[model samples]
Target chain A: MASKIRVKNLYKIFGPHPQQALKMLRSGLSKENLFKKTGHTVGVHNVSFAVQQGEIFVIMGLSGSGKSTLVRCINRLIEPTAGEIYVDEKKITRLPSQELRQLRQKKLAMVFQRFALFPHRTILQNVAYGLEIQGVKKGISENRAQAVLKTVGLKEWSAAYPDQLSGGMQQRVGLARALAVDPDILLMDEPFGALDPLIRKEMQEELMELQEKVHKTIIFITHDLDEALKLGDRIAIMKDGLIDQTGTPEEILIHPATEYVANFVTDVDRSKILRAKNIMIRPTAHVSINDGPRVALRKMKKEALSSIFVLGENRTLCGIVTVERAVEAVKNKETGLQQIVQTDIPTTTPETLIQDLIPVAAAAKVPIAVVNEKKKLLGIIVRVTVLAGLIGGGENNNNVGSSAESGNNVKESARSMDHISDPLPTSITGMG
Target chain B: MYLRSNYRDFFRACSGLIEGAVNNIEALLSFIPITVFILVLVILAWRLSGRGMAVFTLVSLFLLVSMNIWDETIRTLALVLTATFMALLSGVPLGILASRSDLTENILRPILDFMQTMPIFVYLLPAVMFFSIGVVPAVLATVVFSMPPAIRLTNLGIRQVPAEMIEAAASFGSTPLQMLFKIQLPLALPSIMAGINQCIMLSLSMVVIAAMIGAGGLGGIVYRAITRLQIGSGFEGGLGVVIIAIILDRITQSVGKESPEKKAA
Candidate 1:
């Protein structure tokens, strides 16, 4: 995966004599020593991370933990003391002010927590603000803004003042404004923090739907761990300007690396994070549907296979059979298990993350078997996928195979279907 | 017979009001030299505003002396000081009362509006009917004409003190009086001083009109100069009035400027 943004050892300090104070502080001086030399307030300490293209990266922390400041540093809205920030292979932090302005105009746009809509402008004008600043032609910018506004479901309110709109509507205008410029990456700082709970949920859903379509790299700053988990492809939990841990939500939740991370994930429900793949049995030679009915019955009798995946010629899911069906088919003079198989069985794709599959599977009280587009039976999974995923066995249990596949085919099929069936990942959904 | 009866009752009431105003004015003018000496002290107060303002004060005093009507200037000053003292005495207390009670504020509002909008010449007519033409009548007209701004501003200033500061003071266990003195008054001082500036300027302006009713001063000299076609004398007397205006303007402005800072310190 290409790195869309990479931040290395960033620091930002604020004070009356910030530059001189940082100089003293960096020269191996203590706070008291620095005070005697020059005094300043520390805002960001050494922080580092990389966001891959098309990733929903989140920085989670309380208000003063510098998550907002860190995002701003990436955009250089607030300058860092010592750091390197690269966006799309360009060193954004060191860009001259004019070039940086162009960089923001072309590639990056930011959304503020306060919405920061210009009070005097109507919603149409507010949404068009960023494009206007970039000196886009009036008609073109307005048209773009209108299109973006429609995307956020605010087309009818284009003529309304920000003060005339509700808090959520105003925030939609803010989102539309950020979207108007067709930015490659968006930096959002607590964009929904001010809304009521219902509105916030609606907005989060809207953002998720938007991300599906646009797939823009997003750096979302939020204090709500659940929000971070729900939105992030990878979450960087920050404390006092330092990244405590950076990982997928599942990785962080199941095996928190420290006491702080443990406490953060302690309240989360475990079953929700695990899926069928985590608990299902591995494929064996007798698992194949191609085996003759008498051989299959003998295999079932030996290994106690009540039901097993039945794969066709191209390693695609043909269907499944119970021991009773296989035995009945053999006694009735059927040649194969496929002739006796039940065809209407439901299955999930390998991309289906455990956290998302658990609710439907548990409610239905049936294992959602993993399958492919050609109807290939990849593997059978029960309620234990979610459990195993939650308890640190998710990554290990991801290795599921078809009834007909060799080891090579299993690995290849898993790679192709990775994260495709999962509409929402366990790392993100478990926190939600 | 009806007209005669009404006229007799009106005259009787007018005479009583005139007697009261005369007693107050006579007592106020008796302390004239001390008042002039205090005006000089007020000049010193003017100096503290800034060096530039002190320069403005000196120039205005110079213009008054050069007009060659210094004694008349002093008499005019006497009436002005007396009127201003009376206005301040009545207006400040009333403003304080109005500030405390919403009812008083509502009651005084229309009265203040009337006092401000009524013509200066119209005010003198009532004074003349009551006191029948003299310095006492002139002083009464001047005070009534100028008192509104002072009272209005004092009320506004006190009322406009921020609720936060007052709450903070109250939390510290300060009494109502302590809050009024240390917090409200200090914060409101700038606007109150602005009111005083307006009052002084209005009083100086009223002196010229007072000359028409036989209250002699630099205004009488200017009136005589005009009637006798003594253009130079009228010009000089006018210059003297302008000078007095500038000096009073400067001193009141400075007093208004310094009080809040002193309290803050």
Candidate 2:
């Protein structure tokens, strides 16, 4: 996949001699080795990710996780050590300071947590500041700024200074200022972190609406999993200067790849994560007309079946009756069938979070069902598959530093499952 | 012969101060109407500062007028205004420069402290030496004596703006000059206004000592009444000067208080 923004193994270490620190990092020294040799504090380490165009890619981490440092390195706000950063296929990491500044002015805009509006200027002038910096004439910049202010619902307040506005309004002005330049990307550093809860939710909705209209790629950094779930197409969960997991909201909640990710998503309700597609089991053989106990018994013995799916004359699922039910029917001896048994099965679609099935599986003491939107059976995942997805094969204790190699192992597992008769279900955990 | 000459000189000095005070009586009286207007204005100004401050301001104004030098008060105010204008003209740029560079802050700190802590009377000697006992020397001395606080405060205000705000401006495409002018200065304005208020007060306090260098107004009048043992005249003149101080203090403080609101409004 081609990336609009590509970051390759970026690292940032803050110290009195940052240039010297970068020099040492590039020599292939371990972070611990470098720390021992010099007193520099590591802000970001060996972080790499690529953002697809028009994706709302969120970077999630607690404070001091270096997610902020990683985003800053994209624009060289904090210079990265030994990285290849390509913005629009041009290697931006090595651009000279003047060129890098020009690129930033032309391509990037930032919204801050504090809003950072100028207290001295009217909102119109504050919004116009970025255009003025790009050498646009004052009248032209002001005109454009007025248009942007209206876009953010602040045109009526254009003549008022920042001090006259509420916290949410000031942040709207900040958004307007960032948008005034019409940059290709927005770097939002927890832009709503300071607002009250109600205002924060309002701002988030406003941001979603703005993103829909602008379609500019956004790299929004935050620590809140709920916020990440609500806004991100793909979320990268960072811990101790490295990515622990990157996936869709359902994936993160259902099968957290690391203890860090599980800890992060611990408070979330897993039932909410699953859809209808993930809980259905694939059937090996199809039988119609709701077969009698004598015929069902022969097939179960010949096929080595524990359970058989019953289909109606219309070729739709009627119910699943176990081989034990058929044996009990034979023992009744009155017409050789006492009852045609039916039981409710737990099921999910592919879009459903596997975590959502855990409670259903626990309540019914049966494997959860998987189904499509129409409730058509697809495949079922037992407890074994769900657990396999969490730890990647259940027995491999190797840590995530081996991610590049783990991807190959995942593909190999998928292939090996194809060869088995009465094969175990292939478990998948989506991590971007 | 010596006693007679001393007595004669004292009478002449006394008459000169009385004449000066009488000459400025209208200017001093004009301030009563302005002072009343300012007190009302200051009440509005103090609304932003709070009710407690408004009460404090009203009490201070009463104390100032009751001191009894009303005519001489206006002359002292005019001198204070003149010196303060001069100080602002010189101080704001110096403050901006000091804030922009660490080297400049280091260079100017000791100089500002020396100017601030030195006894203000020491300025009178130099004023007399150079401008020779008149209004010009008095104005110059007061301007020099009171200008440091304004510069220091302006510098402090500009330097104290949060670094995150500056970085936000930069990333949003603000040039360095725009960041300083549009972002830093506005955030720093409250502190700068505080510095200017201090400058005005310091200038007013210098006026009494300025009288010794032949800057005749209320101070010279008081000097004269004492020498001639005219207790009643001296008391009246002294009270007039106090009225002027109260009025100037109130007006400047009002102006300072109103600016932030005006900016917000």
Strongest candidate by DockQ: 2
Worst 10 residues of 2 chain A by lDDT: A400-409
Model 1 - which docking category? incorrect
**Model 1: residue B96 alpha-carbon error in angstroms:** 37
In model 1, what lDDT does residue B184 have? Answer: 73
List ranges where model 2 is wrong by over 4 Å: A23-39, A73-86, A90-106, A117-177, A195-206, A244-259, A262-268, A274-299, A302-306, A309-348, A353-378, A382-432, B1-75, B120-133, B222-238, B259-265
lDDT of 2 by residue, A349-412 (tens): 6676555554443344333445556655555444434433343432222221123222122232
For candidate 2, the docking band is acceptable
B-chain TM-score for every candidate: 0.80, 0.70
- For each candidate, the alpha-carbon lDDT, in order, equals 0.72, 0.71
Least accurate 10 contiguous residues by lDDT in model 1 chain A: A400-409
Report the lDDT tens digits of candidate 1 across residue range A1-432: 669999998888887877776677677666555555555666777788999998999998887888877887887767898889999878888787667767777788777777776544578977776676666799999999999999999999898777778999988888888888888998888999998889998999999999999999999999888888888889998876678899987777755777787677666553444344533444442346677678766665665545555666766766666667787887889886767866666677766666576555534323456776666666656433442344343343342222222222233234323532353345446445
TM-score per candidate, in order?
Answer: 0.52, 0.70
Prediction 2 global C-alpha lDDT: 0.71
